[model samples]
Target: MIKTLLFDFGDVFINLDKAATFRELKKLGLEDFSSGMMEQNQLYEMGKISSEEFVNFYISKIPESNSKKLIIAWNSILLDFPQHRLEFLQQLKEENKYQLILLSNTNDLHISWIKENVSFFTEFKSCFDAFYLSHEINFRKPNADIYEFVLEKHQLQPNEVLFIDDTQENTEAAKSLGIHTWNIDPNTEDVVDLFSTKSELF
Candidate 1:
């Protein structure tokens, strides 16, 4: 029986333009993501570096861009959080049938933007029994250690937890650890239809 519902944040609850960052960077004269920049991004996401350091890294590469411009470009990926999705999650929380947990691979900058833009951010977070953000936890998805951390922390049997993420690689990683997963397609599928879409699990 599935006792826990593990969810991803971006492309799952909130809408994200995955390519928006690169497109916005192009406008800032950043032709493409360099190997160093990508490495720095991973470090930033894992909370190894501060936001100021993150912005400085970008500024070092793109001398013409200021901190404000870099921040805007970096945060362009975040879009909207549909009200229907929040309602669905809130209703699910009220049902109290399963333990709802949010596990997201996100950086501080992106989260800050969401807090500012998404009016119901706190309510959305309150729906989760436990919330784990990558930067806060210093662990990222698609890594066995991160999965192990969550499983160990909750004393949850992998078989009894269903991990839902938009990325196939992330879901695949969880599956390797014997966790159930749904590699949701944000384009055609909405999380609000979870029960109808994956009814057998429930």
Candidate 2:
């Protein structure tokens, strides 16, 4: 039986712009056009450094950009939380029908930004039996080891866990481990749609 429902935070709970950072970088003149600096980001997510350090690193790469503006743009992926999704997750939590877990590959600054801006961060987070972040666990998505960490740590059966993520590669990684997955397209699928589809799975 499926006893756990694992959700990805970014697109599942909150909305984010995929291109916001790229646009912001152009404005800041980052010079290096690498996609999302995932390496440095992984370091920050692992709790190896502070958000200030992460922001400063990016700022230093920009020659004469406003640090504050660059910081905000870098954080622009975090958008407003849609109410229906929160309500759905809240209902699931109240029912206590499954082991709810939230797993996201996010970093310190992004986390700090959400903590300060998302009014329901505490309440929403409280709903999860385990809230796992790559930085916190020193693991990130698209890496099989992180999935192994969760399975081993929680003593969870991969078949019993359903992972939801906006990114296909991450979902594919989970699928490789025999975990069921839903690749949610934020521009298309809404969490409310997940209710019917997932219910059928059970």
Model 1 bad stretches (over 4 Å): none
lDDT of 1 by residue, 1-202 (tens): 9999999999999999999999998888898898988899999999999999999989988989999999999999999999999999999999999999999999999999999999999999999999999999999988999999999999999999999999999999999999999999999999999989989998
Leading candidate by lDDT: 1
lDDT of 2 by residue, 71-127 (tens): 788898788988878889889999999899888888877888999998888988888
Clashes of 2: 2
Candidate 2 Cα outliers beyond 4 Å, as residue runs: 35-38
Compute each candidate's TM-score over C-alphas: 0.99, 0.92
